[model samples]
Target: MRTVGNDLVRSQLHENRKWYLGLGALLVVFGIVLLAALPFATLTVIYIFGALMMLGGIIHFIAAFKIFEGGYRWFWALFGVLYLIAGYYAFSTPVKTAIVLTNILAIILIIAGVIRIFNALLFRAFQGWGWTLFSGILTLVTGVIILMSPDAPFWVLGLFLAVDILFQGVNYLTLASYIRREVPKSSAEQ
Candidate 1:
């Protein structure tokens, strides 16, 4: 009976540990992908933002035609006007949008790095803490560099984006690997 109980407890503990490790690995993979896609992502985001804005504007203009029908028509009209204005603003000052986007990216990187570091700290009592710590530090440093160079030109920002994406990709891949390796076979199988 004692042996059986011990075995059950050990199995449960192993499964829990594996689950946590798997989560960590997933986070690493996510980070890596984010870093790798950072370069092209900026342009993609800008294009998408512009496209959405334009689409929204067009929709609003179309909806404005129905305003005469009443039933919250004024609200729709107001929204339509705002959407049109926003779309034009985005189109007319793409550079400004780019700048703001860059800043946002930098902040996101920093925040992600900080979160990774915190995760590492939380798991300091556990084995394999070093990986989390290293990833966290790397992310934090990269984020800081980007933030410090806020005035970087569009090309520079593009470079940063690429680097960020690469790093994030690496992080994610590493994390995934760790999870695969560390996760309990039983837990994973389940």
Candidate 2:
């Protein structure tokens, strides 16, 4: 198993660099487009949420029949019932869900920032660690700002989302580009 894993890794290590670079470019472009359409994007998110609720309800109703046929009727029936209830709640309180989702995003960003800061600190023992520290500090600041302003309107949330996506997209692009340049020149080259 270990040998198989090693072989897989070795094969991947020799794969063409253009694939990673292309993916990175796509991410960057997506981020830019999302940032550019922040206002419309918020509405799109709300619509998607509503659609998901309707779909969930339909799926649950279908599952109820399947569960009855399977003879473990009570357990799956309970799941279907709960799902229906959640679907109703989603349909009735979509605005509330949107607000909660925004808050969740803030919390997630804060957690991610804190983790990155910790990782940067841990990696500081290694050489050439300044860039990591800088990135960590930037992320921490962004997270703190978002968390402190959790009551921000949809526009503000959209703006934050745009910035976050753009930053991450640029980060990934830079990493991919570096890998593309470094890999062919290194010993891992096939």
Candidate 3:
């Protein structure tokens, strides 16, 4: 499948720039708060994750019975059960869950980074490919560090999370500004 680019997202969003600014500001504020109260925030994050996992498990459990056919149904049901147990354990012991989550995050980041770098190389002729390559290198390094030192301080994990939020906020704000500047042009083109 083709990846949806900025043009697609830009077309889908409303022309109202205010919403973007508001959301970006909210995310930045939350990031700041999380950074300031890292320990509590980390715990809070774990709790939220636990809840989501539980919800996913419940949904999967239902799907197993409702949608799957014959033998495949058992697999989904088993998967759902696993999710439920993991979610329950996460809720019961958030600290331990956070540690596990950190390792999982590291693995995911590494994979994502490799993908980004490969794509950046493939599209090196395009503008901003260098940025993608740079970002991917940073991501890969962060993941490698995390993987190597899985027992790093909770604060480090918290800092990473905060940085992610801050970057996301900045990106949103930038996109919002760009949209604001191009609103008239976009409207005209439409």
Top model number, lDDT: 3
Clashing pairs in 3: none
For residues 1-190, write the lDDT of model 1, one tens digit per residue: 7756655655665546545555556655654554465545555556667778778877876776754557566677777777767667667776777787677777887899899999999999999888998998898887787768745435445555455545655555565555456644443345
Model 3 clashes, total count: 0
Supply candidate 2's per-residue lDDT for 14: 43
What TM-score fits each model?
A: 0.47, 0.50, 0.66
Q: State candidate 3's TM-score.
A: 0.66
Task: Write the candidate numbers in order of decreasing TM-score.
Answer: 3, 2, 1
Better of 1 and 3 by lDDT: 3
**Native RMSD of candidate 3 (Å):** 7.3
TM value for model 2: 0.50
Model 2 CA lDDT for position 105: 71
* lDDT for each residue of candidate 3 in 1-190, tens digit (9 for 90 to 100): 1224544555656455677788788889989988997777777778877898899899989999999989889999998998899889989988888888888888988999999999999999999999999999999998899888845436556776787898788878987888767643333246
What residue runs in model 2 are displaced by over 4 Å at the alpha carbon?
A: 1-40, 60-91, 156-190
